[model samples]
Target: MASSGTPSLLQRVSGSMVVFLGLLSVLTSVRCDEQVPVIMWTSEGISLPRQPPPTAGHIVGHQQLASYLEKALNIGPRNVVLFLQDKMSIEDFTMYGGAFGNKQDGVFPNLEEALQSSSSSLVLPAVSWPASNAVIGQLQDQLETSPLYMDPETLSQLRLNASSPALLVFRLPYGTGSDLLSAKEILSGNDEVIGQVMSIMKSQSVPYTAIYTGLQPSRKEAASLSVEAGLGGGRSLLQARGTHRDRWRDRERQQRVKEKPGVYPPVEFKEDDRTCMLLWAKGLTVSILRNNRWEEHDLTPSTFGEGVSPKLHGSNCDKSKGRLVLNYENVLGHRSFKLIFVMSERHYKVSARRWFTLDAVELEYDGTKARFNGSRNIYAPAEYSYRCKSVTSFRWPLLIPRSSKDPANQWRVSFDDFQIQGFNLKGSEFSYASDCAGFFSPGIWMGLLTSLLMVLVLTYGLHMIMQLLTMDRFDDPKGPGISVPQTE
Candidate 1:
């Protein structure tokens, strides 16, 4: 009886402890679902800390914009994710950001999708972006003077999530030609819309949709912004030389050739327009095939610097063939870094005619090979350059995909935000160059000089040989003319 009674008492205590733990878990889960406030702004939009209001429609200086953003990011305990909207033009943005079906219709849809899918407390609906001045002021007033509330269940749900204040800022647009617009012009207005966005954020509820700016960046600005966003632009081949090609002149020349052409034989190498690629590598070996032979370029602080590039100017890759094979190998354990392919044409309006098909593209290093089946048809917005109402020029990354499971083969590159698909490799071995060169013809100037020197030396050597082989001989020496005597 005593033993049985002791066992019964022990079971009772254990059961009580179990009940206590289960109750504690329920309370903990309740706490976990609570939501936190977030502030998201598109690159097409801008946000300023509440202060004495400034003149309406007044463009904010770029320095002021950058300073405000930096302060917002560092000042509070909040989460910030900057949506680099103007980083890439509309077409490129779709190609890069649309793979996951995040972008639909236009820029705002993309932003809304991202916010909806995130764990943030609020979602801002898409509206006419770059809203009028009156709209901006009204939105700002509400955000600054609103008392936001959350329901009990919604608040309970927030308990399971981490809460923090967040601020997001977008990049400014770049215009074309001498009409270059300042960052202030693009990022300045729409304050009221931004304020309304803040109010929605404070509301701690799901927004119906996101605001749309409909303000697509120009081609030139897109390129400049891409580099600024760390997506593609870097020390370009043009920048390396401190000189640039005159696109207008090149365009006129091409037009003349085309007008009187019989299958305009793939524009000769001397006449090829500028197309380039940027490569980043340190202590690596890079080579390009010229005349069916590999020409090596070493990457170092002196020759190729920390990054090197080989600009494809019609010679390295035959224009008639429309394909190029770039060979790379890793030596001395220096791995490759990043590569960006830039394509440009004259006139933002004439950008449609340029196209190249990358076929059977392969990168082999460290006994591992990655193959990409490239084609001109694969690039999005299948419209011709001339037919394109908007600018048609853009840049793309040339790197191995990080994962094999990417949808639509579009993989977001980690080295920079540049997106690419199709090329995937698991091994690292090839070393790449960081310097950009226009003419990839191996041994260019050196080869020319060497050949000339060889010809001169050969000519002199032959003359000496001929003089030695033929001699004027006579049986008797004539004092007037000294000549070699023959033993005959």
Candidate 2:
């Protein structure tokens, strides 16, 4: 009886545990389905609808939202509405109390009241959010603003029409309790709540801009949501969250390029109408060691001319020997760099190809210099042999030491689409430059020989198998062979 009672007791405990876990899961799921509040203000009044909240991942970015509004509102292509999304934290409000005011939750309502009191013209409060105030002030001051949100065309159209654009502000609830609807659901134009909001805007019949300011979903949540939805676009939600750093880097690179004066003019060496050698580059940049990191500085003709004009010379025009000298100044502060290219023609008997090589590259920076010597062949077809035949990263590191404290402080040079033409007699287009001695090195030849030997062995084995005849002595057993008459 004791043993039976023990088994029964254990069974009851296990069942109860399962029941508790099931209930806990159900409650957790219910909590995740929290509702989000969406408010839209129009000339008529304000409308807040009770609808299911959108999942955090499905939220469309500011640009996509603006595009949708433009089409639905029938705003002309020239006219535009400036959309801004501001993310704020509790600490920001506390730290910038003077700029944001004491009431954090009432910030959106305050903006609405201010807009309502104003006439057709949209008048932002002087003490509103930092981003909002700065944009409005820039517009009022006629300063340069990003054309992505506010372009000159849009502003000009507004001035011509003499009509004020409407301003809509949305204050999203903070925290994970409520989730924003996905872009798909909102764009479908089927959601009751979204449709009602659009209806309100259409009824106003005025060009409008919207501002969504509040705490955004956490990075982890946004990334996961973006993955689950499989969004793809130049400005998809995934890219906004995942590739934010990449975008920032690209922008920085563009800014640096803009600061560059220009590119080097194309230089050609001609021998009796037949051009012997031609050199040009889309852009040239040098990497200098600054603050223990490498930073790129552009080298252009303007800077080069300031010191010594670039020189092009050659012994003959038969794609044999040539030299190029480039001198520049003020590349990085008072520092400057010079590059010399030694060119020579080489023939490959194995490949039956004629190409030119960058025999050596001499780099001089500041008072230090280094020279890299070797046969760096240019590989390309006979037609386009004027270019580098081999693909190179185009970044060559110089051993010149910049810092006495650190031996790793070295300079480097990079070329963007550097092209050399007229190296070959029949060459019309640019070819590639080889950074290596030859395409077929000893190791590569060894690989080719081994593969050939394997193929020969395989062929011999197949031949032997084919030569062998089937045995006619297949078991004299069986019975006597039965013969039939050919006529029958």
Q: Give the TM-scores of the predictions, in the order they appear.
A: 0.21, 0.28
What CA RMSD would candidate 1 show?
A: 25.8
lDDT of 2 by residue, 1-488 (tens): 01111222223433212212212222322221111111112222222222121222333332333333333233321222333222222222212222233334222333333233222211111111212212322221121121223332233343322153332222222222233333222212222322343344444454333332222222234323323432121244444445666466546644664576663334544444334555666566666678898787776544233232343311234445665545454566633345656667667798788655566555544322344443533334433534322322233432222233221234555555566544664322234543333578768999999999999999999999999998654434577665546995
The local distance difference test score of model 2 is 0.37
Residue 184 error, candidate 2, Å: 82
After superposition, candidate 1 runs with Cα above 4 Å error = 1-57, 61-64, 77-251, 256-397, 400-488
- lDDT score, residue 32, model 2? 17
TM-score of 1: 0.21
Best by lDDT: 2
- On TM-score, the leading prediction is 2
Error of 2 at 98 (Å): 77
Q: What is the TM-score of candidate 2?
A: 0.28
